[model samples]
Target chain A: MSDNSNNNAYWAANMRIIKIFLVIWFICSFGFGILLRPLLSGIAVGGTDLGFWFAQQGSILVFLVLIFAYASRMNKLDREHGVDE
Target chain B: MDQFTLNLLIVGATFALYIGIAIWARAGTTSEFYAAGRGVNPVMNGMATGADWMSAASFISMAGIIAFGGYDTSAYLMGWTGGYVLLAMLLAPYLRKFGKYTVPEFIGDRFYSGSARMVAVICLIVASVTYVIGQMTGVGVAFSRFLEVSNATGLYIGAGIVFLYAVLGGMKGITYTQVAQYVVLIIAYTIPAVFISLQLTGNPIPALGLFSEHTASGQPLLTTLEGLLSDLGFATYTEQHDTTLNMFLFTVSLMIGTAGLPHVIVRFFTVPTVKDARSSAGWALVFIALLYLTAPAVGAMARLNLITTFYPNGTTEAPLSLEEIQNNEALDWVRNWEKTGLLKFDDKNGDGNIAYVANGEANELTVNRDIIVLANPEIAQLPGWVIALVAAGGLAAALSTAAGLLMAIASAVSHDLIKGQLNPNISEKGELLAARIAMGVAIAVATYLGLNPPGFAAQTVALAFGLAAASIFPALMMGIFSKRINNKGAVAGMVAGLIVTIVYIFLHKGWFFIPGTNSFTDADPLLLSIKSTSFGAVGALVNFIVAYLVSNATDDVPADVQELVESIRIPRGAGSAVDH
Candidate 1:
């Protein structure tokens, strides 16, 4: 029963990390890229506003980082939880 | 070799490679057929998924869409890629842990009802079939242009090739072929962009070049593009022209729709473990970003190139004369595409010069922007082999996606419908045979539709995404997240979503999209301030609310079923939990 409890705790921690990273991911793309475009109108990147950059290029770059971060962290989590393949 | 022969040879060789791989990887068992025995590596699966997800619209038409619509169309870029984040966070890992062969399988098991499964199956079919028709039409367009064949003939040829591989190899075959396709497509796409980038901005990287200074105008690339386009009465390339509310809803809808697509979700099932599935989605996005990052650049640069081609002295000067356009070999692509009836230009008002203006009312020249990507190499005076390679690449994009969609359809028929619900006792061998037969029939139907597309390629794809968003997305999400969603509730939600979305689309587009029956468009949608394109997200929301309300009114879910939901929630021990 203790082992099962520990496993559940481990899974919960992993989900917590995913949720946090996903929030960042969501903000970068949907927030900065779309909804917050007007707010980001003052900050310019190249010829366009920061929000435009976020929509076309910046959000995609951040997505790459988020994914890799999740992968590396989750792998470590898997090992700690004794669930590593 | 001549351009025609080179195109045939390159396309032929690629088709042969796909066929060879299909035969070698031919699935012998149901497990191999559906999920390739779940042995695919994260990286390989990522590449295959990238190829599967990047349809002809991404490869051939996206840049053109952006080129014309400018910053207003950034929704396409954001909406398409934003969905990957949703998939990674909300869907991928849990679904992978659920360990189902199809999306409907999860719905059925999670809700514990055959009727729910049937509803999910119907949704999947409608979305997949509609999606596959678009892909088939893309294949036809690519083949017809490059091979100088009729669209119908090209579609038949494409159907024959897809039937060869998809029917033979199933998921196992399609996975490996898709990897090859990713390589061909990325190379085909990036090489020309790199060349154009260097030519226009002196930056080797297309993505960077998009922001770099335009060598000709001595201004920031995007700024110059915006100025030139606005001068010609086009929307600014970097300015927001679409209504903010519509853009927000459209992007959200696309993200949800992407997460819910059965074909894409099923790709995750091929990974060996739940954790791998999570990372695989990341890797898939990484591969996809390589092109997504470059597409906007291609769109901006291609538009600039096209403008400069006509207005050599900038938009302030008179446009290129007819003799100049006809005599220039660099502009031969325009003439070539004109022959196929895909590209057209009329010297209206009997002017010797072609006025390339974006004003819908005043512009006499009508150029199908779809030709821009297809004719980019020719427009820029690239080599014959590069042009031929583009042909092969476009075909790869179209064919790979078509094969994936057909496989998804076939599996839904064989696994979810026949074996799981109808037969239950059918042998694995019989099931595999049924899958192949279903695939053959699906291909035949798609080919027939391709021969006579109800609408243009991009328009049909929008409908496909709409259907997926409205029906499948809601049912799948509610099934996993809301345990109280009873079988009846889930079924009711899916049917409601499907009917509403389809009826709305039909009313706006046409009944069965028969072309003459449509009453409205993006300008005058049925609902208050809602376009047909944005209706899918609304439909999905309605599905969720209805499901929740109905489920709340019903008896509580069985305790054991709740435990199953708990099992799916935890990532730990899921790898070992797979039923052997």
Candidate 2:
């Protein structure tokens, strides 16, 4: 394949990964912290509802995991696509 | 040693360690001075970034804010940490690939205009200088409280210490010293928290302690806290009271602002490869999480501890008498902070008792929540050394962040504004000298403002984030993602975002934070849907839309630049990119 086609394919793959990770990110912060909070109300942690946990602590943990997961996976993808430095 | 002496000794030793590191790792070249020669290890860099990112506001005041604000203030915790996700995903790796020394360099190159770079440098300096003032003020407050010095004297001392290290070592020294500061601060923060956690919840881990049962109440920690707060006429700790729209916008604004901060973006430039940049962000988040996760627990538990101390029997009983507060040496911490005017209690209603009921009507005395974290060890009847360590930790947090911000300001002035754009013929030695001069001037300005802070430390921090979000975030995002965004569009977006955010902040706050000139309250912001805190995200959206609309009206990006944007979009060919 030509470099232009290769570049197009690579950009497409990168966006795909970013989109997936972002979905999880949205779920944890917006979903768990706000919209889905009522659903999580029954699942209490400590004295507070699960939603509060996500708001203060749980979402932050998930954010760290999401970033690391995206980064390492992208590194592997880079090598696979002959884009590794 | 006496308690005071012991406190002084520990704090002094930590400062000595920082100075020693500054001496050993001093930067030898511009590259080392600005970006640590792009060879910092991921884990070490992460720790250093953690120190750089977690300012005094995070270490000393964040928990206190959460304790008082309850569920409404979860925005601070979420807004701050959530931005890292945006950083790792949208900004860090690509900027690393650009292989630039400063944020303005990337902006200038991508726009193919020196004018664009100059605009970015102005934004960078304005945002960074405003941010550093908060750190310097925090340092002064911490020093005055612990060292028994006046605020002005403390400011000078703080400025001197920052000058010694930041001027000598640059980014290279700052990075290593930050790692040491991180250890000192985290240990100082967690030890007292662990003691309190174990005492309250029978849990050694504070994060878990927040979810565990309160030993005295025999109820889960959060439930007990909520019940106690309501009983004391305060809002429930877990219930949201702020407007939902405001919350959403505020979170988004903070996320973009974090992504846009020049000091933070520049940290990625220290990594050798794009992969390292990506991984280092993960590591940095991990280090930050160590503090971020512990903060709410500390906030909740400290509130509980303080309430218990006041109502020794329970909220059903009479509050602590004024005599108890005034005469009890165990409560010396309260007296200590009161002297600084950060903590004050007025005997409103002429009541003889010190009742800390939180209802607007029932609460007679105004209490600054910033005192809670600073006074926690003392409230818990912990050893005097613990109190001293907390003081040192607060100072470390402030100074580390100040150093980082000063370095960012200096590099933008000397490297991007002077060498890259204005004086291309300047020698490297001359440039380095210019950088040093800029750092010194930045510190002096910060110290001067810190001696007479216009607002509280945390409020000033919000302004910094707002500026970064409005100006830098939009430009960088457009630079890499939108091929059609011309230099005109990018510059226009930044200026629009910047002016709107700054004017809004000025209107709500003072004009340029000069005090006594604000025309609006935060409750009645300029736009119906926008709070000043949340306007950064709004400005960012406006930036995107304006850039797009304007760019479409103009000619398309040159083909070569289109290809460059495409190259940056992919993860491919990232690992081999050299830092320099």
Candidate 3:
């Protein structure tokens, strides 16, 4: 492939990963935590429902994991694309 | 030792430690001053970012807000932390690869316009200055309550300490001092929390203790608290009260705002490489999560403790009498807080007992939200030293954030405005001197505003977040992702977003935040159930739409700027931040 096409491929792959993670991000916080909270109200975790847990604690933990996981994934992708500094 | 003397010793020791760190890490060059010589390790950068990020609002007020707002306020916890994900994936690595000293430099180069850079500087200063005023006031409150000094005296002392480190050492100084501050603050925050957690749930970790069974009642802690609060005619602790649309928008506003703030963005520049920048954000969220995860528990537990104190035999029994509050040793926290006038009691019906009902007429006790965290140690009956440590931690939180904001403001004035625009031919040393002078002026302005705070002092955090989300975030995001967004499009988008958000805020919060000039209130918002704080997301949507329409109508982006976008996407050849 030409260098331009190679760069395009790398960018596409990175965007794919980001799209998946963004979905998970939206699902955990805005989805489970807020909008669809009533749907999960029947399933209890500790004293409250799953939605309440996600809102107060679970979403924050997921955010930390998402960031770290994204970092490592990007690092691997960078090396694969010969873009590692 | 007495509590006041212990507070003095601990607070004094922390100040000396910070000054020592600042002196050791003093900046001698423009590069050192701006980006900490690009030598900070990613993990260290994370810790420093934690200290820089969690302001007095986070340290002193967040738990109390959550305590009162309950499930309705989880937006804060999610919004603040979730923004790190956006920063890491969308902004951090690319900005690091581009390699600049300040956020505006990236915008200026990416959009290929000085006008865009100037607009960014305005948004940055507006958000940061408003944010700093809260910190200065938090410092005064912390000092007066802990060290037995007057509020004005505390403000002056706080300003002097920040001046010594920030003007002398710059970013280099602030970074190391932030690391030390992070240690003092996290320990100060968590130690009392552990005690309270153990006391309430027989669990050592405060985060898990939130989920564990309440030791006293043999029920889950949250379940017990909810039952108690409901019995007293308050909203259930685990249920939502606000409109879902407003909550969603508020969370979105805060997420984008956190990603958009210039002070937080610039911290990414201090790390060595693009890879480090990506991971550094992860590290930052980790350190921050230590406090963030604990905050909900602190809020729940403190609320539980407060209610149980008022109604010692459950909500069905008589409340604590005035004589009991004065004579009982365990209720000393109430009397101490009472002297500050933040916690007040009035027997409206000529009842000797303190009534804390949900309704206005029957509720004789008016308790400020801030007292929850400030008096947590005393309420839990922890040792005097622990209370002193919280005082020191509050100051650390306020000071570290103040220094970070001062750095952002000083660098924008000296580097972006003065060097980039006005005097492009100035010498390096001249710019450094200008940076120091700008920092001093910013500190003075921050202190003055703190002392004579605008009517919107309590609402500054929301305002700061709103402004940053509406104005700065979209501009930076577009500059990176879309080569088609030309200079005019970028400038127009930012201006539109800023104007709409600010006008919305001013309409509800008075013109220029002065009292009695508002056409609307948050309670009866101008928009359809949308408070001004939640309008940033809408403004951001407007920015995106306008930028796209304008970009399509006008000239295409130049060929070279396209290459710049592609280069930043890849991580190769990332280097130290350039001076220009």
Listed for each candidate, the true contacts retained, as a fraction, are: 0.52, 0.78, 0.83
Residue B250 of candidate 1: its Cα lDDT? Answer: 73
Model 2 vs truth, CA RMSD? 2.4
lDDT of 1 by residue, B1-580 (tens): 7788988888788778876776666645555544542676778888999999998878887788787777777777877887887787678878888876788888888988989888888899888877777778777778778878666776777788778767765433456778889999999999998999999999999999998988987999989988888799876777787777777767767778888889899877657777777788888998898999999998888888888888888789888888877898777777777766677677786778888897665565676555667788777778888888888888888878877787788889988999888998999899889988888877877677666665566557767887888898888777666668887788888888889988988888777656678888767677775767767888898898888888888888888888888777666656532422
Best of the two (2, 3) by DockQ: 3
Model 1, residue pairs in steric clash? none
Ranking of all candidate structures by their DockQ, best first: 3, 2, 1
Best by DockQ: 3
What residue pairs are clashing in model 3? Answer: none
lDDT per residue as tens, model 3, B387-440? 999988988888788877888888898899999999999898998889888878
Candidate 2 lDDT for residue B202: 90
Model 1: lDDT of residue B293: 92
Instruction: Give the higher-DockQ candidate: 1 or 3.
Output: 3
lDDT agreement of model 1 with the native: 0.79
Residue B174 accuracy (lDDT) in model 2? 53
User: Over the stretch B1-580, how does candidate 2's per-residue lDDT look in tens digits?
Assistant: 7666877898889988987886667635544644552566789999998998999778877888887777777878888898999899889988887765789988988987788899899889878988888887777777767766666676688788778867875433457788999998999899999999999989999999998988888999888887888788777788887777888888887777889898888888657778888888889889988988999989988888888877888999988777888999887876777776666676677778777787666664454665677788888998888888998899888878887788788889998888887798999899989999999998888777776665567657777888888899999988987788998888888888888888888888777677678898787777775777778878788778888888888877788888778777764455433433
Off by over 4 Å in 2: B26-37, B150-153, B168-174, B349-351, B359-364, B427-430, B451-455, B570-580
